[model samples]
Target: MFVKITNAGGYQYVRLVENYRENGKVKQRVLFNFGRLDLLKNDPAFRNIVKKLSDIVERTTTDNTEAVTIESEEDVSDAVLKNWGYIVFRKLWEELEIDKFLKERATRGRKIKFDADKVSFLMTIQRLIEPMSKLRTYHEKNRYFGFEEDIDLNQLYRCLDFLDSIKEDLETYLYQRNRDLFKMVVDIVFYDVTTIYFESCRADGLRNFGFSKDNKINEVQVVLGLLVDKEGRPIGYELFSGNTIDSKTMVKILRKLKEKFSIDNIVIVADKGLNSRLNLKIIREAGYDYIVASRLKNASKEVLEEVFEQEGYKRLDEKSYLNAEEIYGDEFKYKVLERTNVIKDEEGKEFKIEENLIITYSSKRARKDKEDRERLVSKAKELLENKGSITALEKKGARRYLKKKSKTEEYELDEEAIKKDEKFDGYYAIQTSKKDMDVEEVLGAYHDLWKIEQSFRVMKSCLEIRPIYHFTESRIKGHFVICFLAFLLQRTLEYILRKKGKEISSERIMEAIDSMNFIEIEIKGKKYLIKQRTEGGAIDILNVMKIKGPKNFMTYEEGLGFIGINK
Candidate 1:
């Protein structure tokens, strides 16, 4: 509602009007006529009317935002007694259209006993802020302001299965949405694998024990292959068995990108761990390109000589990096060596492949490498003092630098092995199928691989996606899907803030959000929200999103409005 001036018969009158929708049409109605505009223009008349309305609003105003009536006084006893942080996140949630997508799925599917959309959102927001077990989330649902839906533990468990049923479709939808929303370019994707371990030692087909990156050898684990776009926004992800090797995890994710997402003509960037011959052949056969770290230590002697040769090495100039002088000094340099390499396919047939190998050197890397070897050699010397305790069963890495005398068991430091290892220090190499790409572009694409690694850290620490408590495979998949979507929202928020010239990490975002506080109180049989002190950057976050600040005392409806809900 707003004030308007109406002109009729060559005169003007003051009017209060409202715009409403009726029968799919917008119409305006004059709510009140406040006498002639000439009279109201007199200072006293205008002041009196304004004061009267202001007085009436506190006592009698009732609108969708002013009040949301509860069923009875008993419901007031169960109002949100503590805090909520969904105001900013819900805005992001709606921007990504997750609520709309889930609503469509819920309404279109067979009817169920629970609110599927609300339940799905509850899981996602919980993972985003404070991760916990599904049962725990169900038990604590009333803590958040908007989760008044009647739900139980079984419904939460079932939602995971619901999510699993639409995993591929959901990924496809998110990819398209992210592209449209952020103008994200998915042409170059980074693929890397990590192991997510379970707390239990028991093994299932999918959760069998394998090499644990966490060093939990006795526990079961699952291998996760994550594919992210250039800026670290997730495109899609795949789950593999616990024992699946890194090289073997590539094919399935590649198939997902091609078949599920319909992404064609893209380059997959990865580290040396996934650079197996068979994986490369499969990628080439499927018509995709790659940029993977090279296994320089295992290279043939001739190739190693060419890599270390001084003739072809070109020093990296200041133009190599955007913040070149600040990031890399004059000691950083690189050289690209081209060669015909052999690749083996699934059928064991070898084919000649032309590739450009990028080799880089840094004085800083050499110094660090020297210190690391000296540290290991120092450990080897410490072991020489106690040869009896060095057992074959103990597989510590530092033990490899020790050499035993041929006739006796006395151990001595292997100078030859240490010297041989020193030759490759300060040098790094990257192999790429796109030979036409400039050295800087190749280096830039390969350097951005850390974004994916940072993403993994965000999920494992901030999202807590691992330690699968669900026994069923579908629920496990669903759990990951929930966390993955939450990550997508978090990253999207970060990206938007970055565009606005505000930089924040996932850790700081969660910190500020968790510090937001509020409580519910009853006054004259009407429930209202009493906002507590909000800490950190809560106001800054809202300002960036263009949301109005919450009043110190607001109706429950107003609180709901902050989360994009209306009666």
Candidate 2:
């Protein structure tokens, strides 16, 4: 690398340029720019330093190329080392090949201020390691080792816009890459919807007030639908308006998968929230199977009676029975019944489809449900005693247990309602079109939906995906894309750890990664970086992730190499 001077804006600027080869052709990359050559020329000390540099280069090019070492006799201090956990994440990023993919796709014209791909990479890494606002990321960018990009706040926002524009293509590329890397089996996929609320009270077309999964009902939100493979790896996602219900998103997401991914013959596993006659018919007509939780209380009277009178219940485990043989544990007993249902098509045509309804009674769930109802009943009684009228909001909670007399204008406990609710306690059912698979397989597949739910939790709690600050629709979408990519990296790390028999939680992994830091010290004109190694889970994380921990001490340049920093 050598300094090159260029005249621009009636001033001369000195730029550090390096010659490199790309596509079998020579190229030059401007590494750094020192502004205003006149300032350097006016300083005698700077001119002397330039003369020394020129002499060194001339001697190195001549036959008298001898090794020159500088011995520092003066005492030196003031050296510092920063966190290096990002390096490990960088390795994983490269292993996933996302860096290369983004580099190839993140193209721009010649007038750009910074490399969009590099900015995007740093932004994603920041989101994963230390989530912050774009401004904060820009201000603290230099704190991260090897993240020396010269990007301003405006450039960062522009990069996000670029990311939003290429979101679809990027997701597709990632899906295919993951499939090849993990050998993903697309036969059975799990899907679920979650709501992420915004902090702003002002509602727009995309951020209208709706039901919040985080219980932020007063705030606006957006619904996010995530699809994952059988192994719980994310495949793709869709964002909907906050007012969009869970059931309404299934068709759109399914259609996207079918059209974009061309995935067919897969069984979609979801909770009862997405269960509807229309969704079921759509899944069937599209030649796909579904294993969805059924709202047993909402079933027809015949189905309820059959569920109550079904006698051929089987024990799922040997220790499932609490009282030896007579009293079975609610969680241990399961009964499955095969039934053919007639449903109407969009054209009013009737069709018969066979499905398996597996019902399991969980004593734990029953106890919790009973306790919850009793608490609500007590709250209702308290309200009645206080002569309080049930408002519309109260009707959604404890008020549901009370009945008001029209004549007396008084409230009383509804015995019939309690009894009806108690009858369904401890009973949960799952419906599946997979007739060939056993009840255990169907139940197991349905249970894996928890992974997708956990992924949502990670995005919201760990990554802070909610309470979005962006107002524009495109920026909002772009923000979610970053969150999704961070979630993908998190899931990929978990997958790698699990494959190595390490079974670590996402929180624990993040804790370990965040704690791996280094401290630098300088003495006698020599720099030293000491790894502040702690005796904790971080060590195990480094080992399991195959990341190199810092040695006793290293020079400043050596420290950079340790963290995979090219400079």
Candidate 3:
């Protein structure tokens, strides 16, 4: 069969010439690009037509396909704590000049071989807090630990002792740093106490058992008081007995803070649990402003009646939109707004809990709040089906008797009365010291309180900060101290991500760090090849964090350059 080229239709067409026998006669065919004629040798016409396209073929060969490889090069690397992730923390560390400060503080006593930066010993204690088989299994599989002569298993325990000696000095130095560089002079430090449990038996002056936040009712735990600035940098803290009352201990801690920092322009912010009348008077007498969540249900009946009947306060019922002035000082007026909640039972019974938003405006907001609260109770009661005394009037055992449907199940009305008194429970009032603070600003501070809640979650989940293994007081304190540092590191990373508007978590960051793997590759040459690979997320986070990745398998010389290390 032979084919011939035909015409170009402005557009082009290839005519195919075919020879065949049809009905015992010789026949010929032609094809064009317009329809079925588009076939070419498979036709020589198309190839010969396109051979003139030298530039196009060269371009197609170059652009359509090329050999490429993405190879990761790795060098010796260490997980140095200082990095792009902790910008603010590094700034704070610089501001405090932690190394020099710790050295200066250490000079007050004896000379120590290793101090703040030689924290490998302290880091050992942190490892013990890890889940038992996880790290062990990790090292066994990785075979990386024994690669260095000095990093034997015993080195871990030795480091723990080193950490043990310097732990107190570390904390003392941190406290000094806060006072010298980081404390908020204008805002009251929000201080609260919690307890951590340990398995060991060693006791000290402070780690006595009281109420354990860890829910280890039978285990003896040590109390921990943390005072943080508005920005969440820990400013000061104290270790107390586990059994101490939250408010009583809070006052003692505050008094110490008062003496140490010596700043009187402070306003204490705490929950209702710390708002005892005695505590309030003590703080007030000490000349500090106070913004405590009030137990409105505990108010005197007459006071509550007045609050309900009065009608001058404005209750805001929306998110905050206050400018910066409302948050930082007392000069702003409290904008009184009422907040209401509708509680519904499983069976469709509904109840309304009406509360007042008492924001303090310089000094006038409080009076306005008082006026509004006088009206709040009456409005709240209007929603109550029976405004029967929310308060209990009598003792349980004086007169009430009880009967049971069966003799086996005896119940008393007095017990029922006591239970009834406990029913109207739950926090009621949401107040702020700044009246000019927008509704959202007032609510936002309350929301910031949730950071502590999340810190607890990280402590338990990501950091493995619980399930007390040490029974001794010092070790327990040391355990939490390291955890606190880890928490600091974690939050620092989180803060950076937040400031950058990047959505990532502490666990993910740590996981990224831990997941980073380095390997050794051998070639028939004197060159050593180190291969580093990471989880996909790690690469993404590193990119977001602005860390440049190595282009090829990095040699020892190149890897050392990456980490700023030299032999």
Candidate 4:
């Protein structure tokens, strides 16, 4: 086969022909016609096609006419080029049905410059893989296997606007999809809140100067409340103003759960920050149970005495105990006691709610508390010795160990205060409305709260959900929505890996996915992608995630098919 070029009437024509010997005569038959070689040469697609055909012809002629010989490096026209690693994540996204869901939920209009669903899909994939600005995502489109080739910056901004408009519906759809696919249950819901701050100093109604978990008190912030199942998969989320207190946000979250999701009869697990009398009452009135941590030092004297005197503590392990008398290094001990608290309802009627309190003590916590107190006392002594103004330390409460002499201006160490703090060291309390649950069961359930905390860490550190650049309220919400979806997918992947007995972390998996790339080479107009061997935990990740490992080589189209993309 060869390309036969002909010029006639100031027009150049190119035809692909196959040469053969018929009846001892050399003859050629046209295989393909590439019209107007001048025009075809300027068109990259057509030029690549012609080059591929020419290479095939040359190889065929060489094989038929001469002895085969290895080609030198210079003779090879192939060069390894671009590399992309997002294919694994893209595959996982498809497996999670995100692409299908977006296609169905996102509205596409004929007048739009780009596919809305495609843009949203790319944004989400980028959020999980790279997490860059929209403009950067467009500028670096080629780095991601040309997935965003058609998407522009303006289209991306509009896409976020559209995404914000459909955020609620999209979240509902994702929740249902995840529930059906993972068989997720809502019996036990873990709820927690984190603060994401904005870089801008300007505060909007949604972003206000309040408690900043990131310690950016000067900057505006917002509160993000996330709810997850027992397996740490995100169920839903709510965004509130930064000034909103953690306790105040629970009512809204519970209402959403009951009204929107129709999920009641759940046992909410949270940290001590959300454990308020009002929050507890709200939980009970909503017909739900709660296992919340409580401040041990705040316990009534009678309850504290009872905890100290209680017996029959079961030993949980070698380093932990439940109601044991002796305390060892890092020894954990717990005592279950019933507490009757009087509370007023909305009608202001007084009533008593009997709740079980699990007081836990740890020797490790004791040592840490002692060391912290000593440091604080040292600071206090320095202030006293220097006769420095005590007002500052007194206001900050670090001078609790320093007592002023009743009749004199002198100050001395408050041995009594130090003893009081020492007694409560290594002791914390957990209160639960599940009276029927044993101490061990309640403690274990509360321990799972760390999963939700871990989810927050993933969002803040891995997803970089904080320091948001978007200033508009809708865009800010949309930003969080994207991060939330990213976190959901990540948690789902982690859940699957765990189910398969692969104890890999989301961070490690992300690193592996990022490192898994393909080497692309173009020769004779044919583009080939060779999957590079993955290193580190990527191997086990691919196996457990059911993703195919790298093959030796495949065509570009075949590579696209591997990631559930065609054309």
TM-score of predicted model 4?
Answer: 0.79
Sort the predicted structures by lDDT, highest score first: 1, 2, 4, 3
Each candidate: RMSD = 14.0, 12.8, 17.8, 10.4
lDDT leader: 1
lDDT of 4: 0.74
Q: Model 2: residues >4 Å from true position, as ranges? A: 1-81, 108-113, 317-331, 345-347, 393-395, 406-408, 522-527, 565-567
- Per-residue lDDT over 260-290 for candidate 2, one digit per residue giving the tens place of the 0 to 100 score: 8888788999999999878888888888999
lDDT for position 445 in model 4: 84
Clashing pairs in 2: 81-520, 330-361
Query: Scored by CA lDDT, what does every candidate get?
Result: 0.78, 0.75, 0.48, 0.74
lDDT string for model 4 (1-567, tens) is: 567887878998876666677799987665455567776677444545556545544564576642222222222233333335566556666766777766665544424456776777667767777777777867766656546366678887877777787787777777777778778788889999989988888987899988887888689899989999999988889999989999889988898888878877889999988988888888888999999998777778898787677484545754234333343344776777777867786789876668988877778777888889889888878888777668544624458888888898788888898888888777778899989887767877887899999899988888877788887788888777778778887888888888888888877877777666655554434566655555468877777756665455567887777655411
- Model 4, position 311: C-alpha lDDT score: 81
**TM-score, each model?**
0.83, 0.81, 0.57, 0.79
Q: Candidate order by TM-score, highest to lowest?
A: 1, 2, 4, 3
> Could you give candidate 3's per-residue lDDT for residues 331-383 as a string of tens digits?
33233555543445456765543434553322234445445443443433342
As for model 2, its CA RMSD to the true structure in angstroms is 12.8
Between candidates 3 and 4, which one is better according to TM-score?
4
Q: List candidate 4 stretches off by more than 4 Å.
A: 1-85, 108-113, 146-148, 310-330, 345-347, 382-413, 523-526, 565-567
Candidate 4 residue-wise lDDT at 475: 82
Candidate scoring better on TM-score of 2 and 4: 2
